[model samples]
Target: MTQRTDVVVIGGGQAGLAAGYHLRRLGVEHVILDAQTTPGGAWQHTWDSLSLFSPARYSSLPGRLMPVQPGRTYPDAAHVVDYLADYEKRYGLPVQRGVRVCAVHRDGAFLRVRTDCGDWRARAVIGATGTWTRPFLPAVPGRREFTGRQLHTVQYRSPNEFAGQRVIVVGGGNSAAQIAADLAHARIDLTWVTRRTPRYLADDIDGRALFDAATARRRALDEGRADTGGVASLGDIVAVPPVRAARDAGLLNPKPMFSRLTAAGVEWADTTAAEVDAVIWCTGFRPALAPFAALHLRGSRGRVATDGTRAVDEPRLHLLGHGDWTGPASATLIGVGRPAREAARQIRDLLA
Candidate 1:
């Protein structure tokens, strides 16, 4: 007999765990299926030296606080995993690890989720898989001809791996900056490539009253009325102090954007080419919703179409950990809790 649940949540990352916890609190019957052998999805795969830009106070999940040493800046990736493990144990959230959902289809009034382990039937599904599953690499010319060691930021672990090698980092995101800086300390000759100069911000911008003001500016921009001419980027709005400190330590300089990836490394738009021994693509990620292509997505830029908290096309499906849910707070760990709770309530009501 196929296992049945009122709700089936894909991916046991922060968002999925939070959704499961909220559902359990509401006395709803549900199951969480994750692809990994353990919890804390992307956190488990992060580089060894990675620490959240958000401080411990801001990284807590619902009903739990991320442990931290007093006066410490932020917890490392391992600490995050430990906290997630503890969260699961404390709440007794029903999660099935090592279960990768291959496909999801509508079966009568229910959804059928087929996993490597078994088939699951649910009245609703939450695509809490998060966005990090798919890494976005630009289709530059001659990329396949490059004979050098090429790796995406997802596979990157530490600078020690690239010691004594000339490395080229691509993209203008936080990961690109942090990886380039980390590699610089190892005395590796590194060059950063970006199409546009990435706007860098200090990591302490979360505390300022101006931070709230900037959020208002972001909302206006989202509505397409006003341009965020002088407003800071998301990186600038969230945490700027640590980023500034990294820059002061000579780790945050911008390079012209990527033009091509050649056998001799990367070529920039300015026609400057370097013979890099390795290339690290710190390019961003895309949502992993291809498994549910039947559901017509409604958002701009291929993101799931949702109005505030409700999904437009599929009422039974919801998204978490999306950028800027309720203002800027939606991007952080704390932000997902409210939305998770609201989604859980809606799921419960639908089942009733």
Candidate 2:
């Protein structure tokens, strides 16, 4: 028998969980379909030494607070997974694990979601799968000829795995910095490479003070008299300086963009050669929407196109944990609640 639901949320990570929680509160009948056997999504696959950059206070699902130990700066990936599991139990969110969605198509007024388990008929769908689904690996020449074990950061776990290997950590994001630092502490031979220098932020900041200054700068930019540069917001400005400091410490270095990969290892644009035993591509991810090709996605640069609060063109489909009012935080546990809540309200109104 084909099951029916008011909504079918794809992905069982923080964003999907948040959406499910909100829908449950509104008495909406929905089911969450996730590919992973667990609920934490990417966190379940993160490097073992990873920790949240945002504080616990900001890292909670809607209507639930992340349990915290006193004086703990931030929680580790394990703690985060535990929190998500608990949230699922508390809310009794109906999630089907190990159910990989294969395709989504419209059937008259209903949306048909086909998975490995079976087919579901839903009135609407929430694409909460997030932007971290597909890891973006640049196509460098001779990449296939590399004899080294090349893997994405998603597969990285602990430094113990790369104990004595010569590792080349690619990309300039937070993941690259953290992984390089962790490997270096383990006495592993590590080299960090990126196309451009990254911006890192302080662990703590005066929120109000920074907000005031940022507001002033935004106003100046809007007035057309001053240039705000390419910075999107305060977060971008705050993160730049500290990352440069890490670079100066020899922890991070900008390589002339990736050029080619040889059987011996990798060759950068400057003709420099690094014989790596393992290559860790810290490249970022994109949204996973392969199943919903029938919905006609409006994506640019591999991201779903939305008009601030709603998905473009597709009325029955909405995107959560995407860039709406927030930046990267929108995709994190700390920042997903607001967007999830907003999406729930819209869904409720649509069903009503």
Cα-based lDDT for every prediction = 0.75, 0.74
Which RMSD values do the candidates have, in order? Answer: 3.2, 4.0
Global lDDT for candidate 1?
Answer: 0.75
Poorest stretch of ten by lDDT in candidate 1: 230-239
* TM-score to native of every candidate shown: 0.88, 0.85
Model 1 Cα lDDT, one tens digit per residue, 1-352 = 4789899998888888888989999999999998999877789998776667666777788999888845557677888898899898899999999988887888889888888888988999987767677898888887998998988989999888887788888877667776776776666788876767676554445433333544566677778877553334444322334445567787656677667778777776678777879989888887777756666564567766675545667777777665554224444566678778888898889889
Could you tell me how far off, in angstroms, the CA of residue 135 lies in candidate 2 after the best superposition? 1.1
Residue 352 Cα positional deviation in candidate 2, in Å, after optimal superposition: 1.9
For candidate 1, report its TM-score.
0.88
* Candidate 2 clashes between residue pairs 3 or more apart in a chain or in different chains: 199-239, 199-240, 200-239
Which stretches of candidate 1 lie above 4 Å from their native place? Answer: 207-246, 296-301, 325-331
Q: By TM-score, how accurate is candidate 2?
A: 0.85
How far does residue 99 in candidate 1 sit from its true spot (Å)?
Answer: 0.8
Query: Which digits, one per residue and each the tens of the lDDT, describe model 2 over residues 220-276?
Result: 655786755322343322322333345556755545556888898888677888788
